[model samples]
Target: MPDLRKEIINILDGKLLTPHFQPIVSLTHKKILGYEALIRGPSNSPLHSPFNLFTTAERFNLSTKLEFLCREITIQRYADLDIKEKLFINASPLVLLQPEFKKGETLRLLDQYGVNPRSVVIELTEHKPADNYEIMRASAKHYRGMGFEIALDDLGAGYSGLRLWAELLPEYVKIDKHFVHSLHNDPIKLNFVRSIQSMAVSLNCSVIAEGIETQEEFKAIEKIGITNAQGYYFARPTAVPVKEIDKALFAIEQDTDCKSAPFNNATTAVQIIRDITPISAKTTISDVMNLFHHNSELTILPLVDDNIASGIIFRDKFLTKLFSSRYGIDLHGKNPIKMFIENTPLCIDKNMPIDLVSKQLTSLMTNDPAFIITHNGEYMGVGTLLDLLAEFTRQQIDNAKHANPLTLLPGSVPINNQINQLLANKIPFGFGYFDLDNFKPFNDVYSYDAGDAIIKAVANTLIQYIPAESGRVGHIGGDDFIVIFTCDDWLTRCKNILKAFESTVPSHYSDKDINAGGIHTENRAGEKCFFPLISLSVGLVDPVSTSQCQSHVDIADLASEAKKMAKKIPGNSLFINQRMAAKNSGNFQSFTHSATKLHIVN
Candidate 1:
């Protein structure tokens, strides 16, 4: 035991660990979100994996020492790369507290590495429940107060991880690979992940899936609507992490966390706020002109009436009027600028959606100019027409570029974003998953082009039956579609979608098949069989009146279960899981989430 303890001390006292890094890619941004700092024991040693290294430390009573060494070396190497991205370092409270840290040595090392406290995320790293919640929470707050963020590591794999989440309220949570591994096909693992993701949304926590090693898993995670991912599928951990991921697989879109940037009622309001100070309405016209001349970048000088923006003074128009007659400034220079204060200022709520703002702009005069953004009837800032155009452009790029080429509907990227928004805001909605029964048979005989047309027809029908302003329609690749609807009449609308698609889609089939009832086609196993003409199977996932229906994964799964049930009915059918709305839940944690409580409809 003494010899083992000596070796543990030696490892911590010496350079026995190699610093490896892994890139955490943002699923929505298609960019490197950050690199997680991972430690490796010496090659060709029993301590190669971090698990073995830490376990040995725990056995040797040197866990704290080993943890410190890992953090020190990881921070120094991260600074060596001069990586500007956030660094996620694994740590536990016990590992961080020691006689040395009392002197703020960890913070000193961060300074030596030139790592910003803001950019350093200390992931509460452990596989078991924390021994002391008060101690761990205090440690988390201590680091947070120093501008470091707290992240829960290996969330689902840890005991009491949910309790830690509720108590600590970390900014990020990383799902353990055990749950993410082959999650594409594993219903149980998928359910675990979906529950974590849904609960994370309610807490305003960003979730990153770890150990994603396959494309199928990545696609599944995307479909579940998690915004961040880190695993070998993107890149294996390396000493020097690659800053630019040049692969198309990494081309994720930008993340819009609606928790902070809220858009109510599905409308996007682009908040155009500048940090510029304001001028009062009684300021002399001379003072206004001079202030404008001094700060050339100031486009709109707002006139405040008791802190509320009562009017605005346009920079260009103000200057033009001043020099219009050469002696104009002298004529009105000393006069209070009330004469120049706009009579009808352009003002819109800060929470208004961008599309709604665009419509409001179009209805006004063509020369309406810039509008002030107000919150609670008080001006917060000003927005120009250019800002509106830019926001629209960004949304277009996010939607049109990544959209499904066949159905011309939003593909997985936008679909995930929409789901994330709903989850972030805790908005209750219904998810309808539509699948064509016997679609492969039609595709085999009528050709892929005809199958594509059927998908389009279904997409159009879903869109036609569902309202534009209140729902999101998505194509989850071939033969599958997702719709998230937020109307009180969602159940009726879902029935209409099934009725419309099943009734109209039959015409797309050939006369021989239509009359014969089905076409002969080989199954996936190549066994010849009679495949019925295409029919719609719609699965509906209704949200509880409570926000307990947390994750898109649950809704997606419920929709899946519903769809599976519908498909069993032998024709175009709609199915609802009777127990879903009441039984399915994230109830602070999942053991309480039970399928037995679910109401299943035949």
Candidate 2:
């Protein structure tokens, strides 16, 4: 083989090999929070991507040198970026162990460039097996002491990620792009990502979902609770300045406007049944009668053939048919259903709206019953009156809860009840005690209606982002909303809701407020200060220990501590108290009632 040593030396010495940045966006607000600096070699060099460069360098025993150079360049390039946002730079365990690598020098360079070490996120990529975890842990401790945050990179893509995360309690974890790329369409991948997110949250770490490219992928990640996201869909790697990134971020926010748009202007059976449940044609009259007796609103039954819907069976018609039969005739042995099968069933397509379906079901003459749902001219299923009544009951409950005279979100009682239920169930949940970051100032600047609109917008975003099945969110009076998601996929779900709220809330502001980047106001000290644009401060608590769960009051107190931590950051977001995880995990034996706390927190 040709002498590769000379080429490697030349590539490292002269050219500024650095990582290029790709911005991760807030899906709901459409703003760039930070960038993940991807390693790249010198232009026109054979080792363009750091993957090729590092592979060659490692083979030649120059991995540490390359890692140092990458770090130096990343700090130098994005020095002027805000201290609040993060600059993610990739590092390896082996490279982190180098004694000669001057962390102080790196910190000095960052300070010179107007960057804070606290904002620099060093991602530990598992490029090679980490043989000595102690050394890695020591390196992590050293960096964290200097206000540098650590991230476990390529998490869930390798066997070692979990071990590495446990040993080095990183503040952030970057899930591999492979899992995130097609998560929306793949149920298995989505579930796996959700599990990882929940684990990270319990560990008190935030997750940055990678490789998001499509709207569906973004939505899926959002639904699962990923707070920070990076991939081609947001922005590709580039050597752009922070100002340019800010402009792109602003454009993203504008794109995710929260104006409500109607689903579509069309009528079909599917829409009608939107509020109704479909039953099989094979279902016996006895089942239908039982459903009707239990539910007074049970009227029409939509019968389905195979997956195709046929026609509906009306409650009144079925009852009439039953009574018309000979007294004490063997109804069960005879095809009692055959009588109604002969009736001309009202049929509709499966895509109709529930409002229209409700109207249609009511319009049918009291005597003429039953409407069927057909798709592509094939019978699929049936809709019954009982189904409609059940849907109506659900709607009534939702409407009654949401119709609060105050903030108009589910009321305080509902919010408190949800927290209590989560406590009772022993679910690993997070409570985000949200408050307007600078609401009083904003309210003073504009009318309370505008402020109220902002509050409602936040509430709406929380409801939209949280999965209807897995989580329960309630308005906790004023600008606060309490959200509870079970251990399954709670982390990603919480993050997405916070990001969406952050992105959407600014839309209700005036042009001046938008231009200032947030509402501007004075403080109590008689000093002029820029009140941060409004965002949410979410306190996350995994009440998994008995000590942590002394009572609902105690749990709320812990959650409040986390909320304060999140508020200390610049934007609308969530933060978990570090001790919450450790205490919940039973790592500390100091608490006397550890076992009891564990049961309570569980």
* lDDT by residue (tens digit), candidate 2, 314-403: 677667766665412246523444335432354444655444456545654433434555554455556556665666566557656655
Instruction: Find the 10 residues in a row with the least total lDDT in model 1.
Output: 587-596
Give the Å shift of residue 371 in candidate 1: 1.4
Q: Whole-model lDDT for model 2 versus the true structure?
A: 0.62
TM values, all candidates: 0.52, 0.43
Candidate 2: minimum summed lDDT over ten consecutive residues — where?
257-266
Query: Going through the candidates in order, what is the number of backbone clashes in each?
Result: 15, 39
For each candidate in turn, give its C-alpha RMSD to the true structure in angstroms: 21.3, 28.1
